[model samples]
Structures are given as structure tokens and as C-alpha cells.
Target chain A: AQSVSQHNHHVILSEAASLELGCNYSYGGTVNLFWYVQYPGQHLQLLLKYFSGDPLVKGIKGFEAEFIKSKFSFNLRKPSVQWSDTAEYFCAVRSFMNRDDKIIFGKGTRLHILP
Target chain B: GAGVSQSPSNKVTEKGKDVELRCDPISGHTALYWYRQSLGQGLEFLIYFQGNSAPDKSGLPSDRFSAERTGGSVSTLTIQRTQQEDSAVYLCASSTRLGGLFFGEGSRLTVL
Candidate 1:
């Protein structure tokens, strides 16, 4: 039952508001974490990823995610939001066991930034 | 092509009917993947291919769902005896260097 979980289905915030999206995974070994975004009428694009090294990884468009191994969480955060940031965000996981290389994705979170 | 290309941006078929969706991954990309996206379920991994060979097919929902890749370029996902629950946007992606993926617009299937 190893899977990714996104805490929010929908979120609304005004421009310049701080944003935080929760993502957690249940897995037993070393894993890779990622965040992807799909803009309206656009294909899904990689926002950022965490493989190793520093737990905090920065990505495009002023987005960053902190991987907390103890908590099994990789939460996405942004200091300020923009109207253009309105889109669907997905959390994904990839385990490195080498037997199964499936990359599982969470349900996703829809963010609406009001101007 | 510049990115992954999926045919039939939208498809509507009757229940129990079989449908085929095609994906042309970026040239030289050895890794290709298929995923199902729906309202409730965000992204359901269906299959993965590496150089015309499938290493993982565990994510396929049932025996009715099958996929194949040819020449390490084009892939086809076949759904046999489709059900209403099969209505979803099917996404295809090709992995670039360093594990970054390039996605297609998706083929949206609507089973009536």
C-alpha cells in the first residue's frame, strides 16, 4: 500500500499570499520525490524533485519542497503566490528498490490564486 | 517531434467496445510511460517501457488493459471491453536526460 497523498483537493488564495501544499508518502526504503504542475490547457510539467543531498530543493517559478524523512513528508511551499500560479499540482514518488520502478502520483491539488 | 505526441485528443465509445490509443514519444528517449488521469484519481500509472521492452506492467488495472511499444518510439495502449469507469484522460510521457519527463496533451476517453 505504498502511495502518495496530497492534503488538499482545492485551495484559493489572493495574490502575494503564502502557499503551502502538503504531500506525504508511505514507503519503506530510499525514494525520490517530485512535484509537477499542470496549467490550464497545458501538459503536466515537472516543478521540482528531491533525490538526495540537501533536504530542501528549489524549483522553477519560485517553488520549493522540503523533504522530511522522519515525517515521511515532502511539502511544497511558496513565499508569494501569483494569479498565473493557478493550476493543478501533483505529488509523485519513485522507490529505488530496482525490482519495481513504478512512479506513483498523488490525487493532486487544484490551486486558484485570485488577483 | 518536439515533445510526446498523442493521437485522438478526444475519443467517445460505447461500453464494452475496444479502443486503441497511440503515443509517439520523443525520438531517442529510451523511457516511456503511460498514465490515467481522472477526476477522483489523479494519475494512475499503467505501464513503463525501456527501449521497446516493458519492465513494469503491474499498474495495469486488469487483463483487458494491454500496451506495447515498437522500435522504442511508438506505443499503443489497448483497452478491451471498456467500462464506464474507464473514462479518463490517458497521458503519455517520455523521460529525458536526468529523469525529467516531457508529456503529451493526453487522449481523453469518454465511455458511454
Candidate 2:
């Protein structure tokens, strides 16, 4: 079975601090990766996605993720985070199984950015 | 609708009662999915529907949980004799041709 692991459960960072949330998946086939964010009192929205091509994918709100195939990792990063960036982040992967493809999500990381 | 929509944004029901949650996917989307979010479990995939048929119902936890999509548009999840442990936020998402999904606001079900 395919599974996603997020190493950080909660992260507290001051405004303008660098951010990196670790995400690793267990799969051997071709995969599509994604990062979703859930702001307080809001629905989950796509932050970024990595299907093919370049390893580095930039998303909305100054977010970016890198898909390192060798490490089986797709980590989310931000050069400098703001107070408004406080939200729960989820890392997901959809493995291609010939026909049945389903997305599996990690436990999620709660990020608290202090202003 | 411009985006996915879920009804009864919040629902509270007694244990052993039945509950039905509705989800209307985005227009022209052919794929729909159901997921559950809980404090303990985070997020989990419950089912996926392609058109009006379900190709994957493997994530459903028990026989009491069932779901169906009709007209390839709306979906309803039914839970019979709901248990307190079943309390969680039920989320619906839709996609086109196996691409990124668009999620609804979700329906929070509290079993007391």
C-alpha cells in the first residue's frame, strides 16, 4: 500500500523565517505529488503540484515544492513565511496503478507563524 | 455552481441515528471523492466515484457506511446507526480526468 509521511506535527516560526515541511512517500511507480493548505475557518486549497517535468514547482501565495524522485520526497518550502501563512499543510500523492489511481494524504503539519 | 458544494455544513446527531450528507460536485467534473477528517486520524480517503459508479470503495470503514453518486453530479453519503467514533468532517472533492481535485467546504458531523 502507498503511504505518505509528514515529519512535522507542529512548527512555530517567527515572521520572515524560512519554512520547510518534510514529506516522504512510499511508492515505486510513477506518482503525482501535491501540497494543500487549510487556513483557519477555510476549506483546503491547492498550494502546489508536481506531475512531471521540472522537479521544482511554484504555487500560489509564494509557496513552492520540490519533487526529488531519488529520495522519494516532495518537500514544501518558503523563503520567508508571513503571519498570514499560519495554517495546516498536507502532503498528498497519487500513484499510477495502470488504472486505479487514488490520492493518499499525510497526517498534516500545523504551522503557527508568529507576527 | 462555480465550485464544489456540500450541504449541512454542520450536523449533530445522537448515536445510533442515521445521517445523510450531500455533496454537489463542480459542473462537468467526472470524478468525485469522499474523505474524512478527524483530530486523531487527520485525513483519510473513504471512496471514489467515476461517473455514476464507484470503482473504489475500499476506504469505507464499515458496512454501516455507504455512498452513491447520481447523474454524475451529486453524491450522498449515508451512515446507518452512526456511532460516536464516527464523528468527523466529511469532505467532498471533484476532478476532471484524474487531475487535481477541488474540494468543498465539508460537512462536519458530530455524533453525541
DockQ of candidate 1?
0.78
* Fraction of native contacts, model 2: 0.53
Model 2 lDDT at residue A34:
96
- Where does the lowest 10-residue lDDT sum fall in candidate 1 chain A? A94-103
Q: What is the lDDT of candidate 1?
A: 0.91
Docking outcome class, model 2: medium
User: In candidate 1, what are the lDDT values of residues A1-102, reduced to their tens digit?
Assistant: 568999899999999999999999988688889999999999999999998999999999999999999999999999999999999999998876655555
Best by DockQ: 1
lDDT of 2 by residue, B53-92 (tens): 5559989999999998888889999999999999999999
Off by over 4 Å in 2: none
Question: Model 2, residue A38: what's the lDDT?
Answer: 95
CA shift at B104, candidate 1, in angstroms? 0.8
Query: TM-score, each model?
Result: 0.94, 0.97
Best by lDDT: 2
* Predicted structure with the largest TM-score when compared to the true one: 2
Model 1, residue A22: displacement in angstroms? 0.7
